[model samples]
Target: MASIPPAMAPSTANWHWKNKNVTTWAKTWFERELPTISVQDDGNEVSVSEVVDVDGDVELGQRKSKYVPPMY
Candidate 1:
C-alpha cells in the first residue's frame, strides 16, 4: 500500500480516484493503536498483564478509579 497524502484521509468521503475502493483500503490501514488496548492481571503478584482489545477511542483525560495493591 502506498502512503497517504496530506490532503486525503481514510474516511467515508474519498477525494482521489485511487481511494474509491474500500476493499483494498482496509489492508492499507493495518495498525494497532494504543487507545483500544488495556492491561489485565490474572490474579498474580509478579506476573505481567496482557493488553486486550477494547475498541473505539480511549479517554485521554481524567481517571475514574484508584489503584489498590493486593499486598501492602
Candidate 2:
C-alpha cells in the first residue's frame, strides 16, 4: 500500500499578498503623507491637532505616537 504524504502545514507562505512585507513601505508612506493630510487647529482653546512626536523602531516594525486631547 502506498503511504500518503504528510499534509503541508497551513501558512501565509502560500498567500500571494503575504509574500511581501509592506510594513516598511506603509511606514514610509505615512511619514510622507502625514504632513500633507494634517490640519492645523486654530481655535480659541489649546488642542492637539498635529503629530507632535513619533518614536519607534522601523526594523522591529514598532511605532509610537501620542496625541492628547484638550482638557475640558
| lDDT of every predicted structure (CA atoms) | 0.33, 0.39
Candidate with the greatest TM-score versus the true structure: 2
What is every candidate's alpha-carbon RMSD to the true fold? 15.9, 17.4
Q: By lDDT, who's the top model here?
A: 2
Residues 1-72 of candidate 2: C-alpha lDDT, one tens digit per residue: 223223234454443222223445445555555655534476544433454555553321111222222233
Off by over 4 Å in 1: 1-20, 31-39, 43-72
What value of lDDT does candidate 1 attain over all alpha carbons?
Answer: 0.33
What's the TM for model 2? Answer: 0.30
Please write out the lDDT profile of model 1 over residues 1-72, one tens digit for every residue: 345423333444333233222323333333423333455678634422433433432211111222222232
